[model samples]
Target: MGSEVHECHLVCGPPAAGKTRYARVLADRLGACLLDSDQVTERLVRAGLLLAGRDPDDRDSVAYKEAYREPVYETLFELAREHLPRGPVIIVGPFTREGGEPDGLAGLEGKVGQNVIAHFVWCDPDERKRRIEMRGETRDLPKLADWDGYLTSCREDRPCWPHRFVDTT
Candidate 1:
């Protein structure tokens, strides 16, 4: 906080984990640029579908993932790199650290060194489910429908590498 002209703040967790909400507040408090991977993915998916001439109401479809997952994450990384040199950047996403998927911040870490801080948002299962239902976001219908599977994917209390935990509930 003393001499950091710029830094990286990552707010990460599974769906409905209050990542975007908490990250918004944190970004404002820290004067950091807030970037949400989901929002970026949404825009990418929409444009991809439009360009491909494939219309689908479901945002969770495999088609979207196939078309945009890596690209979206890479784009977010690009955006982060651009902002990091100027000021703090807060990226919100499920940037899982220990999973089979590659860490989204891997490139950034190699670039920025110790200036990056990651915060994982955790919510009680019931509270998360209630929040999911309340929001009723179309992108989450699959997760809500397969709640048990969603829980299975998040069995790790320490899901990823070294990071602070923020219990949103």
Candidate 2:
């Protein structure tokens, strides 16, 4: 008898699109680890190096807000690579399309060598708004600018990343 090989699953979608919830459910069902980006960022923010709110335009500030993203993403990729040997892991994050640029799925696939499954979770705008509201008391829909345009671009012009779209709305 031979052991079955496990494959990594990348769960990507826009913010408040239920990627984390779906990833949690999937992880519970499949016995896989869930790596959530928001949680990761929150953890980094809690380290006290990056302050809660600071000017985004500050060029020379070491403790400026959003400075943790680079290190966090680098840590994410490193963790993904490290977990490859331990079977599949689920990564839940915003893999948005920007200016027709290619998403990170290709680079991840190249690193993991053909055993990655990228899943994009799609949801209706109204449903997304509702979920975002219910999920948080401080939810501010106005901060999410151009939701319709972003969704349209994600559905239409985004590069093909060998993904499966699951609508959990």
Candidate 3:
């Protein structure tokens, strides 16, 4: 892409890692535009899934990952692009797939411009589980039901890109 760098902040971590809370504080401090995936797309995605004969609350299903994930991210990037020129843009999400990819930040820069400040927000496993349980969202039921399996699936290492680590624990 162009050498021109826009201020884009990516706040990522596993579910219940306090990403949203952290993003809110960061956005407030930076006077940035916050575009949270769950806030922007969760309801619509849930509806879309239901219409497609899928469980609306099925956040961990392969079907959701394959079909809805990319589009959901695309929508966020589109919004970020629209707001970037005005000021900093903070995007909050559990970027599990992107974090694992070697060119994750590169791919994001291509989409939402450059100078991306990536933040990986996380917490102790016990605290994460506690938050998940306290939240009590339908989408979190599956995760709570299979906590060990979820932990196994999570990537313990930091993202394969330049980023700041935020421990909410």
For candidate 2, what is the TM-score? 0.71
Tens digits of per-residue lDDT for model 2, 1-169: 2354666888877666678888999888888877786676654544444364543223223453246645655666667767656767787766553213465676766654556788788777778767766766332343244555545534332236567888877
User: Which model is ahead, 2 or 3, in terms of lDDT?
Assistant: 3
Q: Evaluate model 3: give its lDDT.
A: 0.89
- Model 3 Cα lDDT, one tens digit per residue, 1-169: 4444457999999888899999999899999999999999998999999999998889888899999899999999999998887788999988888898999889988888666899999899999999999998999888889999989988767798999999999
Superior by TM-score: candidate 1 or candidate 2: 1
- For each candidate, what is the lDDT? 0.72, 0.62, 0.89
lDDT of 2 at 34: 74
Stretches of candidate 1 off by over 4 Å are 1-5, 49-63, 97-108, 111-114
| Tens-digit per-residue lDDT, 4-111, candidate 1 | 458787777777879999988998898988889877667667667888977533445568657766677677778887777678888777755432234634544764
Give TM per candidate.
0.79, 0.71, 0.94
In candidate 3, position 23 carries an lDDT of 94
Best candidate (score: TM-score): 3
For candidate 3, which ten residues in a row score worst on lDDT?
Answer: 1-10
- Pitting candidate 2 against candidate 3, the one with the higher TM-score is 3
